[model samples]
Target: MVQNSTDPVGWEHFDHDADVGVRGIGVTQAQAFEQAALALTSIVTQIESVEPRQRIDISAENGDPELLFVDWLDALIFEMATRRMLFSRYKVDIEGERLSARAWGEPVDVNRHQPAVEIKGATLTELKVEEQDEGQWLAQCVVDV
Candidate 1:
């Protein structure tokens, strides 16, 4: 189970397993993806100041929704860490559990996009993806960040 303190989107882990495991949430899968990115951003920086001014189109497919979620977040994190960029907008087109999404942001600078934590990678513990009757998709992923 996951709990929230005050954040609109975030991730947490069970005790004793701590950083080795993590859990994330959002109102929708796309939102969850964004939140997961935010959590990653939180790990790498203050987040609130990280300006999202650039955009990129990314499309990936996988049979497993759980793995797909992890892979999606990993790709974004990899771009951020390796490319040093910050994005503020996301547009995801999901069909049959596959995602074709676009992310918008700009390069991170020491003055603007200072990362808060080093997210090593995404994990697979307790990962899940489910759609609610209300029409929202929820994806939970345990990232190594």
Candidate 2:
């Protein structure tokens, strides 16, 4: 069963016992990755609540798509932790094994943002990057929160 939906480019949360499963679906692989990042932010607070007051540029490279996906999300997690921010908007461009992304969000406001939990990192467990027969793409993994 699906939990959350955001249409066109959207994310969903799946059950994972102690952890949460974040999945992104889109018409393209890059879009899927972008959506997955949304799922990551959603873990803490409502994505709609985040104001795009800041923009951060992040890039990651890997030889495999699955590993690349993990690296991409990990980079975002690092930025969030270090910058003390929550990202809501993301634009990802993937070429071969290289990924260039720009995330937009503002500093975390405890009262306004009301973040629920801190996301520790993205794990490789249940990691997948696959294209559907209908031409859409899916990116998912169990995030360590």
Candidate 3:
């Protein structure tokens, strides 16, 4: 998908065997996490189709950014599975190793959402989080389906 200059935060899928790979890019680490969550949501359905009717709070902490990304995504997966919801909007804040975030989405509508697959959890395989020379942050990992 094409990312607009006005909104530097975006997510994409990379080829992976059996599972799917998700990558998020943004100007800040928080934005990258938010975008990565979006990527995870997109794996199941078109994110734009999900309504922001309900709000969910999520948080995670890890000494390393890569592990933090995995924790963040895993928390989201737990919420989505338990709530039977799909999140399209996210706002994240990171202070040191702790991350606080809010995700907004409604319960799944099978007819409208047309979800493709059930995402089990985020995995450490191919995981990475880093800042580029141009100052943008990237967070990525493969998720089990």
Which number leads on TM-score? Answer: 3
Evaluate model 1: give its lDDT: 0.65
Error of 3 at 130 (Å): 0.2
TM-score, structure 1 vs. true: 0.73
lDDT, candidate 1, residue 74?
79
Candidate 2 Cα misplacement greater than 4 A, ranges: 1-8
Worst 10 residues of 2 by lDDT: 1-10
Q: Which pairs clash (backbone N, Cα, C closer than 3 Å) in model 3?
A: none
RMSD after Cα superposition, model 1: 3.7
Better of 2 and 3 by lDDT: 3
Model 1 lDDT per residue over 29-61, tens place:
666666555555555566567566677877778
Over the stretch 1-145, how does candidate 2's per-residue lDDT look in tens digits?
2344435567888889899999889999999999888889899999889999899999999999999999999999899999999999999999998999999999999999899999888898999999974657999999988
Q: How accurate locally, in lDDT, is each candidate?
A: 0.65, 0.90, 0.91
All candidates: TM-score: 0.73, 0.94, 0.95
lDDT of model number 3: 0.91
